[model samples]
Target: MSVLAAIAITTGILSGVWGWVAVSLGLLSWAGFLGCTSYFASPKDGLKGLGLSIATNLSGVFWAMVIIHLSTWVGIDIVGYVVTAVVAFFMCIQAKHNILNYIPGTFIGSCATFAAAGDWQLVVPSLLLGGVFGFAMKASGVWLQETLNKPDTELCEEN
Candidate 1:
């Protein structure tokens, strides 16, 4: 997780230097905030975290786009908040299904999408990169735990 965060921070700084401020912010959000969410949700399982992260990020982008479009025809502020709530509700429902728990990802995705102003070109790639890096970090953590021959029961209890 530390290594993943370091990479994310470095990437954000580099992105800002390159004048991609929106992308930088999105990456920072993913690395710092969303990553924590994934960690807490899945613990030592990187693959599950990766899947959830990707799904949530993409869901956010989709919802952002929808809200943006709807705002043009309605009250922007109202639409924004309402749409967010709706997405959250649906995501929670999905989370209730054991194999389909992806609410966290949706939250991250929505944040990233809004940060990037629903720009597909920007949001899509950034989310993908963040998701992949996050996954790799979690996987590495899992590997380290296994290499140390740590008991799974102990790890679960710590979480």
Candidate 2:
């Protein structure tokens, strides 16, 4: 299959899955989609992309939770800005490491957590599930291409 075709089909199926998880489980599919996009938009592609997506996204969630917890304890709303800035600096500098190299992915995850109003309960599982969905989308497409486009000689040998 062509790249676009595979992407289109995978997207269609996964969107349905995401939708079901959202409405039935009362989770945030949009947040999950953000995580799914993290996979595609990582600095690297393929399995490495998936790994970076998971790593950076989870890191973002962890940092966001820390900021939330600390800001509440400090009892100062403005302090969130300072805390976020410091965390952002770390997020950027951490890109020097290969696994956490995707700064934008971290930002996306962090923003999603904030948008969900500090509800790590909702954001964490949703984002993780989305990453799994993203991997499934790519792997299934590759499987389809390999299974359907095999040579006639290969098919005959299998039979």
Candidate 3:
């Protein structure tokens, strides 16, 4: 199995064992983000993709909070429209530079955040852990690719 898949499966098992649904969702969302970025964006643009994923996740959470606050002042229906527009506008602006390619990943992260009831204490740690896992997964993929591509002599030679 691929390293990424193995990591995800391990994370899933551990999260399920600990009954940490939020962490599980966060990790899954991050894995999705990494996969999307890796597939859609160039390998050399990994950092850019990572930054955009982070921005999108942060914006999703921020917008969710805004919508919640506005719902109290206005109404859920109106607030929904406003929030949608705001998110769309921001996403469009970001997309202009092709940096927002991981939009699905952002939405996944947002869903994970909302699923955790927008609790900062819970969400922050979960997302951070997910990010770390995502990075490790990506790095593992890179390492595996490099190893596979190396000549047999390189593999057999002593360091």
Candidate 4:
């Protein structure tokens, strides 16, 4: 419960900071938040979580781009649907790779890109920065929890 509290506090503060930075820089806070949420879903935490979130998430961006281009190029409704389906298959199957195993991150990345109307330029940097924010959020939370100090459980004596 203490750990959960730590995470909640960190999430609230960082979310505010992230929104501020986004508004200041005219970036999409929601998009960056999407990436941040993806971090918790990552296979590991610390540097590994950061790296995996970025990698798997970017692959999603790439596949989404492929879906957009190929579908547009084909110039048919059915073809577009097929292209999306095919790309989706690839996206899911990519979990076969050890490093690219976080499927939700990929989905989140793709959704972010699509929400941005495929502006990877804007989304890329935002998502990348999001990974950093996510790392900081967790690190600070864990640190705060440790600093505050707490017992995980207590034993009771029977009278």
Candidate 5:
């Protein structure tokens, strides 16, 4: 149920942002359902996950858009795809707690927007970046988990 809701909301945000009239509302509705479920399930963690997902994904899109808008200056012809791949990879990496499971569709959806805007060069780079991002995030996740699992009073109690 929550998974389905998350999918819908993610789709809606991407579609709506790209002005896809048919899918916008539907996606938004799903997102709303996810929000409601998150609110009830584990308020702090759920909300934190939602916020992080939005920030990371949206920021990726924004950066991609900028890359597309100034492709020539960056010496990169495939700005859209490159950005998408990088963002996708990072999304997978930053999944934090299985959150990355929601990445594929969201990535394709956002990449579609950039492609529609006439930036095809970004495709390959986006894919490569996505892989790299995933690996990096996994490392970070492990570190975070280990760090968080330590007893808080151990150091504080000594010296």
Candidate 6:
């Protein structure tokens, strides 16, 4: 979780340095806020907190979509939704223990962005990313399971 926060911050700083200053700053700020709130939460609670945090972030997407709709970027609203969906799907695959717990946030984000952009372009890419994430999780889970199933004797070999 802390690593996620660090990644977000790093990405934001990189984006800012690359000229998307306002957007980067906003994202970084939101990540910081959520990271602080999640600092003391348990793993289960942390997943729930992430959902809540994403729900809040969706508000920004809503407003950004409104602004985009009023301006020249008329069909860009779905971009944010697609990005979030892809991330969420991967997150669920990686952490299936409480994956379904975030459905509410995913639904809310997808609905909001879809409504704003009215485009289907987001679906295919999101699904592709989801599949990739699922595969990765499957591989990792198998590895972990095998490791855990090792015989006690193998683990207790003379040092």
Model 1 ranges with Cα > 4 A deviation: 1-44, 75-81, 96-99, 141-159
TM-score of each: 0.58, 0.87, 0.59, 0.90, 0.30, 0.25
Q: How far off is residue 7 in model 5, in Å?
A: 11
Candidate 3's C-alpha lDDT?
0.54
For residue 28, model 6's alpha carbon misses the true position, in angstroms, by 17
Clashing residue pairs, backbone N/CA/C < 3 A, model 4: none
lDDT of 4 by residue, 9-116 (tens): 998999899989988987888888878888877879888998889998899899989988998898999999999999999999999997889998898889888999
Better of 2 and 6 by lDDT: 2
- Give per-residue CA lDDT, model 3, range 65-126, as digits (tens): 65556655676687778776786566446545555555554555556556756664555455
Write down the lDDT of every candidate, Cα atoms only.
0.59, 0.84, 0.54, 0.87, 0.42, 0.39
Ten residues in a row with the worst lDDT in model 5?
A: 34-43
lDDT of 5 by residue, 37-83 (tens): 32223222334544443443344455556555666466765775676
What TM-score does model 2 achieve against the real structure? 0.87
Off by over 4 Å in 4: 150-159
Q: How far is each candidate from the true structure, as Cα RMSD in Å?
A: 8.6, 2.0, 5.5, 5.7, 14.9, 13.3
In candidate 2, the residue pairs with backbone N, CA or C atoms under 3 Å apart (3 or more residues apart, or in different chains) clash, namely none
In angstroms, the error of model 1 at 86 is: 3.3
Residue range with the least summed lDDT across 10 consecutive positions in model 6: 33-42
Q: Which one wins by lDDT: 1 or 6?
A: 1
Candidate 1 overall lDDT versus native: 0.59
User: Which candidate number would show the highest lDDT if scored against the true structure?
Assistant: 4
Ranking by lDDT: 4, 2, 1, 3, 5, 6
Q: Which ranges in model 3 have alpha carbons more than 4 Å from their true place?
A: 1-45, 75-94, 97-102
- Candidate 6 structure quality by residue, lDDT tens digits, 13-117: 433343343244332322332222322231333335544434433433443344444444445667756655555455345334343344433334344344436
